[model samples]
Target: MASSLTKGSAATGEKTFLGHPSGLAFLFMTEMWERYSFYGMRALLVLYLAANVADGGLGMNDATAVAIYSVYNAMVYLLALPGGWLGDRVWGARKAVAVAGVVIMAGHFLLAVPSTASFFVGLALIAAGSGVLKANISTMVGQLYRDKNDPRRDGGFTIFYMGINLGAFAAPLTIGWVGQELDWHIGFAMAGAGMALGLLFYFIGFRHLNPVSSRVPDPLSAAEKSAVVRKGLVWLCVAAAAYALIGLAGVFTINYALWPLTVLGLVLPAWSLLRIKRDRDLEPVEQSRMSAYVWFFIAAAIFWAIYDQTGSTLSLFAKGHTESMLFGFGFPESWFQSLNPLFVMALAPLFAWLWVALAHRSKEPSTVAKFSFALVMVGLSFGIMMIAQGAAAGGKVTPMWLVSVYFIQTVGELCLSPVGLSMTTKLAPKKYGSQMMGVFFLAVTAGDSTIALLQLCGVPTDTQSWFASQGALAALAGIAVYLYRKKVKLLMRGIH
Candidate 1:
């Protein structure tokens, strides 16, 4: 990996790190460990919730557990809005990400304390922290590559993504297993350790982070300075109001209060962009693509809602109805969570090659085709679930069934997600590139939260009926993608 970094750097005249900056490696490692902690926590969450109180778990009912899971997952991506705002208009990306990492570290430490109060507090802090790190880190990655048309851009993201999966692939099998088989706090402590490693790397390589966008003030022209102050005050007021309301409406569910704010959060940006288009100098294509990017965010959110359920409903599915033994080798349930990232690591290179190969032949499918494929694969994963249900109707369901489902989902992810990253970079106006990426991730927020909500509504773990209902939604999403495939394709006409 270091060799690849050096080789890319050499190729790029040694100005950038492995064609980005040496600093990129620091960010990569930081993100890798952060994901390790996050995915590790995720792998154990459902099992931890469903575990009996006698087994040192909370013994929460599936519905309530799933709801919390959904909200937490949703907030992970949703917090990016304010995170990016802080990075762009307040502190800058690097500082925001660093601070966010610290916050996440604190969250993990809270989980290690082993109290119900600490658990909720820890989750809230981690969610807020992810909002900061998740968006800004990617922005820094883009900053490392000064050349917009650099051939290494896609490869760089691929490399960065691999780092993510490295942590993801290991976390579940290790931290999750230890947590489940022994103590839950041990897993959380492991997560906290991972964050510490990430923070260490960030500080160690801080000097290499030149050209990084900071949240600190730049030497601005008169208009730019005024704009910054105005936006800052607006965000400050909004945040204060939102916090005040949260405190006042203590009886209301956090999700209920937050969802409305989510809407408000979205509209605020839309209003900003509308004014930009109406009054500020803008390119037509840039404006159009930005609009399309918003729609894509909605679509992406839907996908995540279905996909991220692995941590909530699907984890339970493996534990409950699915027969997880093979030749008397009963697989660890947390091990199942490892499959997605493992497949991603295994197949990403092949897909990257395939995409390039297709492009060379002038036969590459449009971005919409890739997205349609993603929806189809998502439906197919659930279809496998449906089949597993049928196979297990009278007896144990084979572990192969769930494995097949994860494999299929991974393929869908390969087609849709990495490609979506490229698409986001292509579509957003230059000024809003990082913010748009943040917006693209909002789909994850909606998707993960939606999954959690489904679980809470008694559709995921407690009842086989609820689990089966997911198949119907997956099917509908596939149909919707198919029906609108052409229209979506039209939006991508000039993106590539």
Candidate 2:
């Protein structure tokens, strides 16, 4: 293990994989397998719950299944708050991630045991573990390159993004096929194995990590340290309140709840902005950028609300309505999940090139422009699905319907997701970057939770109706984007 660690470090420092750290490859492959396990399990979730008792699965109603899926997904992102906080405030990124991996590995193992008690227990572990690993790992990648001006940063992120999708692409096919066709336990067990591999690689490559990478310095002044602790506690209270409200409200009522939770989420940051405005501790430009980060968070949440349906409503749509076939061969329904990642791998380099070219010419779109475009592309993807809905209502739509939809959406992701990550790192004040990353992941949490919330609200589980609803929701989201375009652009001013 020590030898492997040394070898990996040497490789990472010496060669840039596609112009960034070879360590990027290490992170990429680790994330890929982790995602494969994650999405692999995800593809099985609804099917498992909704399947008959004789199928070696839990027979749950579609609404309940989706609701559970949403909560689980949301928790994964929600944990990022504590995970990132711990990295910034206590353990640092490397230790936090290692601990998270172990917890997840244990969680996956619990699931493989085949009991209702174990099942929920496994999910709880997974959620807690994900909270630790998910947010910090991305920040660590952003840490790798020294130059904020390095043209390779975006491409590196895109490549890392591809690894995530590649895992997603393969997971459903491999794990989904085994679980659905052979034994569900087989797929569940594979997820555990995947995590073990991820942990193995991550630990072996730990030495390659730069000491400066996300190393939170000891708070210089007692006052500063005290402020961080206080702020962190405030966030903890806020997250608890958010979760409490969700539990108290019925699933359908969660949408109404978002307004208040959204307000609550921003309270501290807003207060910080006011302080900045007063010139209490920060400069005017710094204050503006901090305020801009808050707005970016809002826009990001809105985007994820539309994008994250891939795991919930979209997953159901692929299974139920869309035709899944390649020539004479019928592809596993879960395999369709790969389209997003597949397109991501293909287009990431191109998008990376486009951004650099435009930046060089002073023709690059503002961060807000990039964000708006991401929303527009996401809407366009849904628009195509709406067409597929019409076709499927008549009969089976071609599998290409889903593929083509994922293709367009992947373009939107290339615009939105990784750039959103970059935007946070760039726009946020240095003292607050990790925390801001945590906040960014929170948007993902809300968006994912919203997907399940919608499913519980009215999204159909039956074949034809579900596709139609996806189209309608997509249209609504697009309208929301159009209305918010100018507001989004205003936030870009403080961003470089």
Candidate 3:
């Protein structure tokens, strides 16, 4: 919408790749390596933390390790709120992305150093950089289109999402092997190198873009900047005080440390929704659409509660409850982390075509309907996991069980994730673009909160019931979404 090239004519014309803009190709490559860096390090995080110091790990307990991993993962998403603000208001999205890349690359390099201090510092930097990069890069992908109704939109997003899996599919195999089988720092260093290459490709192909992201969506005035700085310091102090209180009370464990962040995971999305709905600039239709989005948002939260796309939990499951042996060779548990992304790489193009083909026949499911179906897929995936867990009580089950589960979730992911990305861009207010993208990611954070709460309270002794209860809840939520799909569509005010 900020295009300098005649309403994004350049975006749809001249250079093209796979029937879309060539800029999509550049973004695709960039995202591939960024995700490569992310998932690569993510695959090894909990394992490294839980490993013995004799093996060059911190040797933390299972609960602490898992809690830290979940909170770290959730924070990476929660920070997207501020990241989006900076992208839209402080700097242009393009500039924000480039700077965030440097931060992310630096973070990975730091992790390569293999020290306790270095590890924490590295995680902080990567989380902040990732939060910034994730929101803006996705926003940039949306900018490559002409308008909300562009038929190329979903397909283009699927391609970009495929880029994510391309990296995810490969990183764990390479980085996970090095981290788990060799040296952890070397694997982290490899992640850094991946990010650096992403930066190189991004800068080399910068001119391919339409420069639509160059214009700030909303620039803060001098008065607003001063106000923001003042407010920021006050909140910073409040945070420090609360953190100190946790230490003073002598409950400064990882479980307690996560309280603020997990609570933020819940509070921020709700606050963002209420604030958006209250915006005076919104037309009646915009208000209606925002209201409609609340259902999608909540449903997505429920879906992610069962999804946990990080694979950390499942990697642990694979380590203990599932076998990684094939013939005479054994593989690391992290190898299972690659399954979801590999399936995405194989399935995305098909799903992309399916949506367009359905659209041509006027038989395409509404976005809400697709979301309903996704919930059911995840519910069913968990049902299988429940059975697998029950089977594990007898002995380690076949790896195919986990494989089947990832395949089902991948189907759910193909239905919801990329479509959700495209849908957010469609529904965003003209002025609040990047921030709205950030709000969409909070679904992941909200899901993290739910899981973290369950984990911290205590592990459930009955693993089957644990899985069954969650699976049934997801099935019920799916039915509820299906029942309300018609009303949700009406509230969309013609978005479909």
| Every candidate's lDDT | 0.75, 0.71, 0.84
TM-score computed on alpha carbons, candidate 2:
0.78
lDDT winner, 2 or 3: 3
Sort the candidates on TM-score, descending order.
3, 1, 2
Model 3 over residues 125-151: C-alpha lDDT tens digits?
A: 999999989879988888888677889
**TM-score comparison, 2 vs 3, better candidate:** 3
Residue-level lDDT tens digits of model 2 in 1-496: 1133234334344555555665776788778878878888888877787677887888777776776777777777776776776777677777778888888888888888879778878888988887888867877887777777867786677678778878887888788898888888778889989988988888776665666754664423578778887998998899788778767885534344334433433353345445434554665566666666665665566667667667666666776777777788977677776677677777877888898899999999777667667766776676676677667777676888777777877887787777887787787665565566666677776666666656556666554445455545544554565566576556545445
lDDT of 2 at 190: 94
Lowest lDDT sum, 10 consecutive residues, model 3, at 1-10
Off by over 4 Å in 1: 1-20, 146-151, 211-295, 429-431, 455-469, 491-493
Clashing pairs in 3: none
TM-score, one value per model: 0.84, 0.78, 0.88
- Give one digit per residue, the lDDT tens place, for model 1 in 1-496: 2344445443335645544657778888988999998999888887887788988888987766667777777777778877877777667788988899999999998998879779878888998998889868877877766778967676777778888999999999889878987889999989989999999998887776755565353445678778978998999999778778877978546456445544544454455446544534557766666666655566566667678777777787777777767898866788899999999988988988898899999999877777767877787777667767666667767788878888988998888787788788788777775566666676676576565545434564544455456666665666776677666656655675
